[model samples]
Target: MYQAIVSPQEDKFIAVRAGQQAAMQLPSAFYAELADLTDSDGVVPDWFGDAARQAWGIELADLPIRDVLMVRAPSVLPVTYSRASWEINKGCNFSCEHCYLEQRPFAGLPLPEKLRLLDMLRDMGVIWFEITGGEPLIDQDFVPAYQRAYAAGMMMEILTNGSRLYRDELLQTFVVNPPHKITVSMYGASPETADALTQTRGAFKSAYRGMVAAAGVGLPVEVTLIITKHNVEELGEMRAIVRDLGLPFKEYGSISPTYTGKGTTLATQVPGLIGKSEVFQGCPAGHTSFHVDPNGFATMCKVGRDNPISLIAESPQGLMRLPAIADAQMLRTGGCSGCKLSATCRVCRPMARVYQEAKAPLNHYCQHGMKEEP
Candidate 1:
């Protein structure tokens, strides 16, 4: 794999080849994208943007120039996936209030079918799998699915609320085979609060016990907290708890509305989050990253829920054609075309229905001037 290390301080770009910094510089073609990337303040410091513009003939001369663009590998890289995430089933033991997934019947793939899908994923060039679910441990065929993927030479990860990891077979399987990481979600800092949040009595103790037990076996473990009003003040304490468990790292994310694509839980969102005003990138679906439901339907992301890229419907040859299909479907059209703030706008048509109060393309949560396009 070739790696181009770009320095924000200077135009110094070097490509790493064969584990060494190859004498080759980033080919001149990547400069403009690189510059626009660094100048997120909407300010291009130097002629890098210009060089990129002239080289690439960027029509949005309105966009930027001579900058050294970073040619990032797409999610669908030749030999590896940027990422792949899936929920084997919606069956979870601990029910949390902020959960995006509502339960469907336990209709996940069977073990043989799962192995077939795993083989298909390997064929499709997925390098790793982030296997998550209502609780992946609750899924009957999870271990077989995981082991199959691993045997097929793919890296694997599991996301759980941590209730069932302490099981001997699971603990040993992970200790011996090991995953890239096992990320556990901590609902709250204390037993009462955590259990209260999950609506499952004793779930907090079970989760912590699983974390401790997994770490005791030397498996890589991480804990993440989804910031919500209920646990907002307990962030530091949660970090401390994870630290006490001696997990490798901790992370946090903002609470999102229920993910059934209905935005039914939109009212539960914590507005106090200090969010960034970052601009839009391209559609993540059907491209760099993809999500597979238990049913083998694929999409660029779990959110859009629009175009269904049915994995079972496609042959291996058909799967290769997906990137183009994804790229074509990723465009923003109509009112989204000429909007200057399109870069910063968060609302898209799919989630627009979630925040369906306003029928316009504007983001209903906009504290900025995004409501009305000038």
Candidate 2:
């Protein structure tokens, strides 16, 4: 495995180390020169060695390019997105009530097609990649697909439930090729509460064991405390558990309807814990980042999935339409079209539409509901 990666992040070129924040900006000419080199070439440019030494305190002058660094192939496509998230599969071992995905189908592209999808992502110059799922680690092709993307120099992060993190196979794979981070969701501190929330017997034991195992091995692990009505009382205990484990944790109390506008998931929301979201600001969902579903359809983001383009059928060329698609979805259409408080509305137009479609209570997302807060 290579120690560093040289790739394009939008308009700029950078050399970044996997699992580390260390990075150095590279000149456009230097990036061009590296991009021109064939993948089989073993030549290590002299400037890279000096720069790497100066920046990261590593010696690479005498090593072959392939041995020292993975030089990512520059893209010729008009779109220059550097970040992307992939849903490896929508299946999970535990069935959580507040999951955003209404349907947790155990299906995705076959291994060969999954590899092709990874290739497309690499060709699109995606440097920061997130592999998520109902539980990504449960997927059969996850290891091979992960290895492929990591080899291609994409700094990867896995969003998982941590139920399978204790598995030796996964630990070995992660030990070999460390991901930039592994984020695990903590539902509750106790088995009774967690199992009830997830509707799975022994769910807490497996997940807690996995988190402890992963942390014991020194994997880059972070915890997300999923606060809901079922487990809200255990908030302090969950924080104490995470603190004992010596892992960073973030609390998430707000819940939203399913991506397909199913409102059932919102019933689990702890209204008292739902904090007001920040005011709407512009984002770079399509211009600098995108999300890919299990079947290889690319959308601006996970929430604003309007017109998805098939990355498998059209390949990277289809990305040319993404920016326009993203921009169109951002328009305040429907009920929000002529709203006076559009500027101060916390939810984006696409999210607001979904909330409306779900027939959710106004206070759940709309500014109208926020104004009624006591």
Candidate 3:
């Protein structure tokens, strides 16, 4: 039986997946007719959102049409990803003390290999590509890798440190075919403080020059501030610096210590500024988005970079099954069990791995809600 459901945003018919069966596009008239027959409760039912493909054993031709707007169809929803972050390389020119990669090697697949990986992502229907790295622009293969993504009609978001963007060659390449947007991380307000934080000479100047050059070239630019003790005192001034740049600005206060799940390197940050309950809200990792490390292992996000499924081994065929893959990796554990903070908790499988050794999941990972040592 055809059950009609209207789109929450508009008076449009909701799309239904026929699954392995024939594809079905329930017409608007179907919904209107169904509404006339069924009891109308003005509110849109919760099941409306969960609706997907029609169930098995129900022959499409034989089933009679029902005149109810909200027909109970067993939702066999398919998982489709709209955005993906590709950590092209783990290499960076500068050695920022708090780098989540924790000074991991600057290694990655060669240009030809990376392009093949990009092909897999494109075929799998990833609409948005967030090209990130230890610092993407500095990588030797970045230009070619980016060129391939642009050619594929993917909306590309570049995450860079702004160290190399000032060069005329790099600037020209970007101008030739610009990205959707470039997000630059603002380390410090002054050259001395910034260089000190980056632990490299002339880093602040180079990064600043590159950021400004991108803006001058008319490429969309965005700056984000990483709140660390090294630069926390100058937060006001840092915001002012980005403000003068006349571009969008964002602030990130949380610092995850271990870049990879292997080591216990602390990427320290400001104390008690952000509360635990305030921070551990629901995460969209498996739900709406996911990330890929330099090695092509896909995970829900960088925070929990473990149990990454190999993109190389699985694509188009297996990659199309990400919804099931993500659902199976659903993040929940005894650590969060019985805690009042569970309702709004964003702690997931990756984070659980982060503090697995410490055995104090919430206190170790969360900036707030510090519990005393046992």
lDDT values for all models: 0.61, 0.89, 0.64
What does the lDDT come to for candidate 2? 0.89
lDDT of 3: 0.64
Candidate scoring better on lDDT of 2 and 3 = 2
lDDT of 2 by residue, 11-88 (tens): 789998866667899899988777665365656678888888888788887577766677777788766679999999
TM-score of 2: 0.92
| C-alpha lDDT of residue 371 in model 1 | 34
TM-score of 3: 0.71
Clashes of each: 24, 0, 4
lDDT of 1 at 25: 48
TM-score of each prediction: 0.70, 0.92, 0.71
Off by over 4 Å in 2: 30-63, 372-374
Candidates arranged by lDDT, highest first: 2, 3, 1
Model 2 residue 13 CA deviation (Å) reads: 0.5
Model 1 agreement with the true structure over 213-324: per-residue lDDT tens digits: 9988887787887666677778889888888877755555444455554454444455545233344454655665677888887765666555566666663344455566
